[model samples]
Target: MPIHSKLPDVGTSIFAVMSGLARETGAINLSQGFPNFDCPKPLKDLVYKHMIAGDNQYAPMPGVPALRQSLAQKYRRLHGCDIDPDTEITITAGATQALFTAITALVDRGQEVIIFEPAYDSYVPSIRLCGATPIPYKMQPPEYKVDWERVESMITPKTKMIIINTPHNPSGQVLLEEDLLALQGIALRHDLIFMFDEVYEHLIFDGIPHFSALRYPELYRKSVVVYSFGKTYHNTGWKMGYTIAPEELTREIRKVHQFNVFSVNTPIQHALADYVNNEEWYSALPGFYQEKRDLFVDILRQTRFEPVDCKGTYFQLASYRTISEEDDLSFAKRITREYGVACIPVSAFYVDKSDFKVVRFCFAKTPDVLEAAGERLIKI
Candidate 1:
């Protein structure tokens, strides 16, 4: 008998594989991009308080009204964009769910979805599951910047959407205003939907500004902006996120979202709403994360590995050429087993993994964990 699988090429994710290896080898696990610390006490207390106040139940199909409204206020305050929460926002289980829902809602069979590579792993699978084609345009390493000519060439009549992630994962590069403008040009010329995954929006470092697709009103009309609370709040296990789109686009996305997860945990939504509304808490995030990022980079400077300049995200990419000439995956495993440190190969995020020789380490860990990993890495 043959196995039935819609996603035949997909198997265990790199995060899971590296995590299992870390556990087996008793290595400092820096492969997956998750914080090794607890969320803010205020947010946690709010969650418990909401539970005590009997806010536990199914939220509305869209989301709790307070959360939706708060999200709207956040956009206005941060991005200088006005969004009608009642019509333009629909919360999902997480940004992962929101991405899938948007893809399913917007794409048709045989359509092409332009994706920047080495993209988040989930994007490809979601596009494939929607019966659409993933047209990947690679971003060169070191700089990890997009080539506008290549991107423009990839657009076609069948291209329905282009997915962009700023404060990019694994690469730790942030999309610039020029990059956004380039994408806006393509969208305007070709009439393609623009989707931005900005879960790491607030994690930018070194006084770098995050450019949002919402900054352009024309682009926003045809864009779906997805964000995750898990990334911002250090509560990845919570898995709560929402999308901001025009009313018509949101209506279609909600059709898929309404039946998929229906709604998120009611109390979690309410608590998150209160958290976002607090200006002081979210405002300090850049400074908070910058410290950890700088600490990890400083430690890497003492090692043979040359860490890339990371403008945003908790991840920092290190080139292992000075340490070994081995391919990235093999080098990652070698370090994990012999050095007692775990990191993800940059190739894991690429469509073709043969050429890349970098690995990603999560700097979201505590100073002690970073020091331990750094000690082992430098010794090697």
Candidate 2:
């Protein structure tokens, strides 16, 4: 029997495709956004300690209390906003799940979700599965700046939510305070749910302060903020993340979350709770990633690819327009097979898979790995 497909167009993700091809061809993979290096040794040891101490059982549905409390303290200290760990935060498998859970809870059939173009791949599929319409507002390259006027004009009575990511993936554009203010205005006027993806919160660069929606009282009340422990702690495989919202919004998300992923990993939750308490661990991330970004960008300058200004995230976008006029998908695959370096096409992030002659490279690897990748890229 042919099963009906909700996401007929959604096949294997581009990240997986490129990474797979890189593996098959023995190419250096800069396609996926994960570090090639191991996480902090002490952090690993703590997880081992917890496992040995018999914390292998399932965690509480919302999360381990200790972990939630640690997160609450961090948010209070960083954002100056008090969050009730028990009521507001729910740990999930990853930011992806947290995002899907939020959308599942808020959007109904025929409701519209306004997502920016070159948006993350997961957003539209999640929205579609809920029978909601994804209304994309395309942001041009080079800047990918959000025009508040255009965003405001897209609003309608059926608009149920607006999803945004800062230190945006594929493109490394960070959201300014003005962007948040504009979103706040639109959300207030429409009484819409605001879903903020802040997984790359700590990965921002160049002295730019991360403007979290939790910073605004009104936005906080209406927003569901998703964050990744994997992104922060450099253990994407652990798949630990959480969502923060007002008590009421959280209640709805939790209703869906309980069944989706009743609980997160046990030992890791205990381990992360202990590790994150040290301020230096995450506080140093910006500078750490900035060094990697600088190394990668500096090396890429030797190539024909024109690098875009990367504000945050480990990913950097480079236009190959000068080198080839081919569409991004073909260009990405060809480079992986022929040039011995792999990257993601920026078009894969868009719903329509629009081409921009741009490709995204992940620079979260070691300097030597980036150097090797850079040398291969220079040949193209």
Candidate 3:
């Protein structure tokens, strides 16, 4: 029997591959975008408390009312966006599901989605699964800024949506207010929908303010904003996230969401209801991660890898060109097997798997783990 696959060419994720390699060879694993440190104990305790109080059942199809209410309050307090939780917020298993559901529900079979390359691995696959074409706009190194002219030029009648991520993955680049305004103008002119990935919203550094899609009224009306509790609390394993959209858009997303996992973990939803609004914890994240980013950058400067300016997220890109002319994947594997340091090849993020002689290193680990990885890396 012959079985065709929707994603036939897709192999195992690079994160899994490099992490596996690190495990097998006892290398320092910095390939995946996850913290080596444990999540805050209070968050864990809150989950336990909810579980003990009998919150183990399925959550509401849209999400727990209390949790949604907390989120509504949060948006109002932080981003000045007033949301009606009942019609606007739906918690998903993670940010990935929210993105998938939105793409599937809104996009037609022949439509196109514009995604910037060296993108998050999930975006292209999600777009392809919808029978939608993904248009790649290649952004270069040192400054992964969006070329709005090139982006607008790519738009056709078939172009239905544009996906944007701030505090971006791998590149660690962020879209500023001016950038968002440009995007807003484009979306309004073209009547395009937006899928805004802001999971690393709090992880921005050097006092850079995160200009969320929520801030743009015209864009927010046609956008689904994605966020992750796991990214905030250093607990990616938990896989908790939510989406925000207008009532009509939310209606379509919930049509897909109701059957897809039905709802997120009830106990976690209950736990988050009590804990999500801790202004102090989220407020202090930028400075906390900035220290780690600075330490990692300083260490890499002494070595062959030249560190790029990392504006946001815990990931840092390094130019390995000074030491080796080898392709990124081969170089990444060589370093993991030989030097005992694991990093993700930046090419894996591109549709062409474009090698720019750069690789991404996760700086989300604790000082001791980072120091240990640094000590080994400097020797090479």
lDDT top scorer:
3
Give the CA lDDT, 0 to 100, for residue 222 in model 2.
90
TM-score for each of the candidates: 0.98, 0.98, 0.99
**Model 3 stretches with alpha carbons more than 4 Å out:** none
Tell me the spans in candidate 1 whose CA falls farther than 4 Å from its real position: none
What would the per-residue lDDT of candidate 2 be over residues 161-263, giving only the tens digit for each residue?
9999997987899998998898888777877888999999999999999999989988888999999988988899889899999999999999999999899
lDDT of 1 by residue, 1-380 (tens): 98889999887998999999999999999999889999999999999999999999889999999999998998898889999999999989989999999999999899999888888999999999988999988876788878887888887889999999988997889988898888778777878888899999999987888899888887888999999999988999999999999998999999999889899899999898888878887778889989998999999999998889899989999988877889888889889999999999888887776456789999998899999999999998
Candidate that beats the other on lDDT, 1 or 3, i.e. the better one: 3
TM-score result, candidate 2: 0.98
Clashes of 1: 0
Better of 1 and 2 by TM-score: 2
Put the candidates in TM-score order, highest first.
3, 2, 1
List runs of model 2 lying over 4 Å from the truth: none
C-alpha lDDT values of all predictions? 0.89, 0.92, 0.93
Error of 1 at 120 (Å): 0.4
How well does candidate 1 match the true structure, expressed as C-alpha RMSD? 1.1
